[model samples]
Target: MTNSPKPRARGADKRRRLMAAAAQVLHRQGVERTTIADIAQAADVPVGNVYYYFKTKDELVQAALAEHAGGLAEFTGELDKLPDPLDRLKAMVGAWVGQRETAARYGCPTGSLAVELDKRDDGGLDLEVGKVIRLLLDWVERQFRELGLPDPDDLAITFVGAYQGMSLLANALRDPEIMTREGNRLTRWLDDLPSAREDGG
Candidate 1:
């Protein structure tokens, strides 16, 4: 007599499914353009059932934001297993380059969402949207700091900005090579940066 999965476990799985589908749909279609019914369809959950997990579209959007944040944390944790700061940072850029086609099509999962949310007349949602970008920026800043950079924060902002800026152009131009080219340039730049200790900072 095997025990069946608990109701709580089933509920959690359904909630996670909703959030994952919401993230993909939101990334492909800006927040304003996406609806709870669309997410319900994508998740394969009944439209009425969606409200049991997410009462409003905004709630679902928040869940998607949390999903992105969790994914970023997990990805950075994997990179942290690499010993050298430079290696980790370069690997980060490599991953981005690997996703050039997707970025060219979707304009970056985090960056596109951030841009769209930031422009919203509803001020509340925009405030929460920065969490995704801040996570990446803070992670990059930590890597730079570990490399003994004198201005890790500034370097982190510039590094992340370069990726976001190029992602925009790549999507607008429908050119994946834009990301490949800029990612390579950023990789080379990362390799060439001098450590603060070397400069006696």
Candidate 2:
């Protein structure tokens, strides 16, 4: 008897589906309420299959956090396309505000994960969140360096802290307009920096 053709590996596809499902669950139900069962159901996979990929709920949470970080990294790439560092900074801020607005409409997967991950004193989850934050901070610092700033690290930290604080406030108040305004103000401040001014001139 002839052997039938073997199915494709499909492992990558299955992993992507699981991550997408986890993001949906986190966005809709909040990270604390999201369960393995919910992710399995959302992905249309058996519980055993989910367990095969993730040994524990925390592992799955970390995977979801990685996915969120991946998305932010992609946003950084888009900002890098701009020639001017000040423009790049503004684009980055605008992209973040736009993402927050979109997430508010459906719910924020990253914000939900951040809330839970931040509370834990020790875990891989916190590390995953740190990775995401660090990536964004690094991107911001790169822009500052390109602008010839004297203190890229400090300025990047300040920029990221202000952005995150404004985002949390906007999300809490359910006010995208506030986020937009504050983000623009911050961007303008960066643009007016001496280094940026000389670069632009």
Give one clash count per candidate, in the order shown: 0, 0
Q: For residues 1-201, could you state the per-residue lDDT of candidate 1 as single tens digits?
A: 999999999889889999999999999888989999999999989999998988899999899989999999999999999999899999999998898998999998888887888887878767777877898999999999988888899999999999998899999999999999999899989878987757876
Model 2 residue 178 lDDT score: 70
- Reference-based lDDT, each prediction: 0.90, 0.76
TM-score to true structure, per model: 0.95, 0.83
lDDT by residue for model 2 (109-145), tens = 5655677778877766766777777888888898888
Instruction: Give, for candidate 2, the lowest lDDT window spanning 10 residues.
Output: 102-111
TM-score computed on alpha carbons, candidate 2: 0.83
Whole-model lDDT, model 1: 0.90
Best by TM-score: 1
As a whole number from 0 to 100, the lDDT of residue 31 in candidate 1 is: 90
